[model samples]
Target: MPFTAGRGDASEEQTDVESFEALEPVSEVSEIFIKMDFRSFRGNVA
Candidate 1:
């Protein structure tokens, strides 16, 4: 999903823009991540 952890400077802002740029394509990846075991967030998780 075009995942990124941009840090320092204005990287968070830049990542927001980059995420929008990849929206259509990354949406698919995002959907996959949503269903992935590692990404699942149901209930209390550590």
Candidate 2:
């Protein structure tokens, strides 16, 4: 999705605002990144 400062598509802006409003707070710290092991990473070696 394009994050325009302003004067973008009106529908997209409205949808983004509505989606943000619908979110609720969570108690736990969210995992923003995935944890991986070195061997496991090697398994997907291309």
Candidate 2, lDDT over the whole model: 0.46
| Candidate 1: tens digits of C-alpha lDDT, residues 1-46 | 6765645567554656655644444346556566454465544453
lDDT of 2 by residue, 1-46 (tens): 9565865557664666656643555443322112222444554656
Query: Between which residue pairs do clashes occur in model 2?
Result: none
Q: Whose TM-score is greatest here?
A: 1
Q: What local lDDT score does residue 35 receive in model 2, on the 0 to 100 scale?
A: 22
Superposition TM-score, candidate 1 onto the true structure: 0.21
Determine which window of 10 residues in candidate 1 has minimal summed lDDT. Answer: 21-30
TM-score of 2: 0.17
Compared with the true structure, the alpha-carbon lDDT of candidate 1 equals: 0.54
- Which residue segments of model 1 deviate by more than 4 Å? 1-27, 40-46
